[model samples]
Target: MTEKPVLDSRAKVIIAACEMIGENPASTLSVRTVAARAGVSMGSLRHHFPTQRALRDAVLRTIYDVATSDDEVIYDRSVAPRERLVHCLRQILAPQVGDEARRAWTTVFDAFIATEPTDETRAAYLTMAAEGTRRMEHWLTVLDEEGALVPGDVRQHANFLNAVVNGVSIERALPTETSVLERETATLYQAVDAVLRAVDQ
Candidate 1:
């Protein structure tokens, strides 16, 4: 006899949260709703994530995982270093997200901003942002060690790059005409190229 498939509580909650974000970000996400959507008991959800902050952090991490999977493809050492860097920058600017996915992420961001300030949510969000910046710094350090980066402060370079990326993301969320979209899209490549030229020897 075949055994029943075992579901992971954490994964179930993350998936359910993602779905809810897309469906109705304006609505408060409750434990009951997430548990029901995941087909798991509230106890099961809490077993994995003891608090709502923990659950939100998990959801954000899952989103980052999905966004950055293309990093694997660009990590091939056989490729030229400059080419790889360009590819990585492009990937960061243009995450492989469809229209619906884009809207879902925007919705989450909107709700997060609109909600009254809370210590837990703010802390979780700041931690994620810091981690992302650290990842950028790590990449820059790698390039520096490879003798690709110009002799300068790697941390500062990473900060600049991170800021540009964040700007691009904010631009993407705003509604715009096709002509504006075309101009801003070109700026993505230009920004990447400028940063690389400044850093690359």
Candidate 2:
């Protein structure tokens, strides 16, 4: 029997959208551009996503899956708990895991702030935030189960870590003297170290 293909045309379009966002987050995303990038026709893109909102939501969902997928984490029991925790947290900051989720976030936020924020747009923001929180909480829960977490609320710790990591991204967004990549990498390591120190009993 023949095996099935991994990504269908619709999925290809979605991936193209993500790559486009990564390439130029501020560019106005048009179906024609995305379809061309995916090597599909505009009709094919519309068949998959009838509206721009649907296409954007699909990209967000894909990003969430990429960032939160368990496969991203190393499951080696031999690795120390703190080491594993840092590795898992670093996945959130790396784009290779999903083309730098920060860019996708910036694109979404730009859309929200650049235009009149509507209830629907606000809802999308909340949905993405919840997904991120849930992913962070999962990693923290794993650490807590392994007895690596200190005496504190796991949810709060997750939120704190998320806040700090996002702060790094925010600061990097502004014009600065230092190289953004250098600053981002250094800040990511420091943030992870700080979180592990606080959480490791």
Best by TM-score: 1
Error of 2 at 53 (Å): 8.8
lDDT scores in order = 0.66, 0.69
lDDT of 2 by residue, 57-86 (tens): 678667767765654354555766566766
Clashes of each: 0, 1
lDDT of 2 at 29: 52
TM-score of 1: 0.66
Q: Which residues of candidate 2, in runs, are more than 4 Å off?
A: 1-10, 16-58, 67-74, 96-109, 114-116, 177-201
lDDT of 1 by residue, 1-201 (tens): 999877688778888987774476443457788999999999999998898767766776665556565665445667655666655666665652346446746665765686775665566556567656766776667777776665678777778778877776666666656675566557655654554544441
Extract clashing residue pairs from model 1.
Answer: none
